[model samples]
Target: MQNKLLGVIDATTHKNGIEDLITNRSMSAIPFAGRYRLIDFVLSSMVNSGIESVAVFHGFQNRSLMDHLGSGREWDLNRKRDGLFFFPSPLKEPDSDQLGSFKQFKQNIDYFYRSDSQYALISNCHTVCNMDFESILQRHISTHSDITEIKHDGQSLEMYIIETSLLIDLVQNEETTGYRSIVDVVRDSRNTYKVSEYEYIGYAALINTIEKYYKYSLEIISPQIWKQLFLKDRPIYTKVKDEPPTRYNKGAVVKNSMIANGCVIEGHVENCILFRGVKIGKGTVVRNSVIMQKSQIGENCELDAVILDKDVKIENGVTIKGTETIPHVLRKGTIQGALMNS
Candidate 1:
């Protein structure tokens, strides 16, 4: 029998809204390792697993997302039966603006249950990695887990410790001890006859659980409830692969660091997280900067920590450095200082 899987793309705010202020954009839309946006990883993974139906939950500041993923044809997700679907937050009134991330997510849950699919794969765009959901779904079936979470072990403690603590406190009672790490909380949350190893990759596999507990309940639920439902017993299993850890392209020379994509380089590059389609002019010495999509740098122009927004241009001999700690936000054009949206 063919199993229906839904890939839910969570295009939420970035860490406490810091990145959002700069770009006023969704994390999914954030420019990453050259030539690939953050949402590309999740969307590509779904396509790789033969999942054609996807619903991307887009909230605030999604114009760029709409522009980049127009019709979803590039990823082969544009189809009549199973293709990419955009689920934006419902407006309170006809004239009202978009809702927050959590509000949009709750609406997505409603959309998932209304569908004819059996399983749903909920993912956030913050993570960057490769995943095979077909294999993961098979494991979930064999284990009969109501909810399965995808997890990674190597994340820094400082990054995940507080979130893990909050999860434990919300899901478990006061008597629950030894909740030192996220692993401990996962171990305690299982409601099955036997425990299994399942890494919580901050992603989840829900089998009709959204309908059972959440349908007709409320438009929005607490994070605690979300965590409790996520931890529900069944047979949570982790699909760990010994693949080579992701690395930057060799030909691409990054001087100041912050390179993300699997980019291939043929020319010299310095100090930039060159988001995909960023072509460097030969002998271009880009110092301390972020260059967004398809921006071309002229040869010998020195850029220091400059935030070049989408489709920006820099003429040769243009030196923009030491403006401020925060890089100058340059929209489309050959800019020298800051270009604020007016």
Candidate 2:
């Protein structure tokens, strides 16, 4: 089933609720869990499931997304033959609400026709889970279904498994069928397609909003949930960064925080996740926050329930606080000085 299945990742969805972080990037490129992007979970899962010849369909403002997935080398997908393929759509305004947009798929329909895979696994980019697609494919074949949608806890995870030929037909006759996407074909009962469900009882979270992102980001700090998402066998792959070990200077106090490499810490931190190359100055207290790559916090600042994007610098003596329901988001490359304290 591995070699017979093709992987399709839709990276064009743009969520209004996550606008602060994704204004300059795709939702898939958003940083998560200290060192991984949001797309890492799903992409790595596909690789682990032995699915080669994956294609990513992205939209504009895909610089970071393309950069993160360069040559797909990190995922062992930089093959000479059937490897990673990227398709950049020309549309500016996308149907951000839906998972599988047939219009976007139709733009690059030739790729589907050229591939020799018998089945195609279509997925959205925002879901975080360590799934095994081979198992799903086995079930789809056994049931003789036209389309199989993956569900978790009775809710759709926006993932589907369908035959490559059928998907191509749907894309070609979308106008005549009046079906906008694979989602539409599943929702409307007029079609003769046999839609099946595969219930997945695992750690799955769909992050389309800042609230869900913040909630799930912090929730993975628990050791139990961490183990479920990250397994030694099914490792989640990301762009490898060569950096020195984190440095905790004198008087640095940290508890229950996950800090990545190349970080210099001299502050009192608790319940925080700091990404690579971050710096926490002396006398600062950060609690229940997520600091992304290359961000620095000055001395004597107090941060709680906040998310600092990449390259952000917080000046000394600034205090910022947000409730768990609404996290304070500092955009990418922002420098928050004393004048901008809240």
Superposed by TM-score, candidate 1 places the C-alpha of residue 134 at a distance from the truth, in angstroms, of 1.4
Evaluate all candidate structures by whole-model CA lDDT and list the values in order.
Answer: 0.51, 0.93
- lDDT for model 2: 0.93
lDDT of 1 by residue, 276-329 (tens): 556565555766566665676666666665667667767665667644334455
The candidate scoring highest on TM-score is 2
Error of 1 at 253 (Å): 11
Model 2 over residues 42-127: C-alpha lDDT tens digits? 99999999898899989888999999999999999999988999998657786786667888889899899999999999999999
RMSD of each: 14.1, 1.0
User: Candidate 2 has which clashing residue pairs, if any?
Assistant: none
Worst 10 residues of 2 by lDDT: 89-98
